[model samples]
Target: MNKTILSLTGAVLFATGAVVAQTMAQSTSESTVAPQEADAASVARGAKAWTNHCSRCHNLRSPSELNAELWDVSVQHMRVRANLPGAVADDIKAFLMSSATSTGVQYSTPGQGGASVASFAHLSPGDPLHGKEIYSQTCIACHGADGKGTISGVPDLTAAKGRLTKTDEVVLTNIIKGYQSEGSLMAMPPMGGNPDLTEQDIADVLAYLRKEYDIAPGTE
Candidate 1:
């Protein structure tokens, strides 16, 4: 009777140990797979969000130009600019950082013999006149009619000397990526919240600003 009792206890212990090991293996697999799945989903959602909301305000550029810290600031500001819901905005930020500058390496833009000339010449021209109308409807409140900002601390569009001198690529990239100016409470919002605008619309607006404001494009 004593021997039978001991054998029963040993079998139970062995079974329990096997079950625990299986459980641990399963848990480890899930832990590894979950992050990869989440990352993929985040990228897909971010790409959609970029097309619908961001492409209107800016063009796609290499992610390497901005550091993760810069991207963090820019993404937060864009949340307000695009009027994105909290969850969606978070996803977009995650997506951009993962693909663009997560490695902290600087990226180069196309053309200009590797000089990193930023330009929207890749996109078609939009109607500058229509862009002006769009600007009036959405952007004028902050950027003003002349593209000069009326609010204190807003960038002066009429005198965007440094910005315009940046390659058309840089200007377009800024419009798309968005950024926080030093010592300013407000960041430039994406597309100024005009979801109807397309890539061409942004291109057109830049053209209008360059011509009307005499903002010269940068040379490589």
Candidate 2:
């Protein structure tokens, strides 16, 4: 009798969670792709892409954040704002819809454990335009407005995207932690020498770099 009661209770909890997730999905503003277009392989690719690309700027957003339609709108906005290619945008949509509210199952975006770039809260809610302004004031002196940097000591912000190995979480430490250039005598002050810069300012700067430089999450 106890075992049966426990089983029933577990089922009840799972059912409740599913229902709440579904309701959130329905109410969300993200636009949804057609159900038929969603497939396992594409979803997997999207997960990988999300980890590499999206996670750079933000955490793995819960799938329930938006309904199908809202996901469509959100993805479309990112495509233009972040310059996602046609096929990739489609894959991400399919993945988000499929995972949004599956009954009796849970999903987290895959391949998040070994972040290639450092991560931080500053980059999580980065605003691209606002980031551009911050970058102009703080980062431009070293990284250059075009992101080419000083070539010898400073890293080229534009090119780092192609070779980025650190996760955003890990990369945040790089920004927040700061670094001394190896064998090059150039030293970057922790927090870019400005204690007043908020995490949002950092986030915005990272966002601007990703958008303006077209930094796709590297395979690394």
Cα lDDT listed for each candidate: 0.59, 0.58
lDDT of 1 by residue, 10-100 (tens): 9999999999989899886877575433254454455446445665576544344465467667878988987889667766665556545
Model 1 gets an lDDT of: 0.59
Q: What number of backbone clashes does candidate 2 have, counting pairs of residues 3 or more apart or in separate chains?
A: 31
Which candidate wins on TM-score?
1
Candidate 2 per-residue C-alpha lDDT over 1-220 given as tens digits, one digit per residue, 9 for 90 to 100 = 9999999999999999999989878655354443446564566455445445665565556455566678777877877776889678877776565544423121221135421334353335778899898777656645666778633456666665432344454444455545443354443434553445666677677777778977754442
TM-score of 2: 0.41
Q: Give Cα distance to truth, residue 180, candidate 1, Å.
A: 1.7
lDDT of 1 at 9: 93
Q: Which stretches of candidate 2 lie over 4 Å from their true place?
A: 1-124, 160-165, 218-220
Model 1 residue 210 lDDT score = 78
Each prediction's total of clashing residue pairs, residues at least 3 apart in sequence or on different chains, is 6, 31
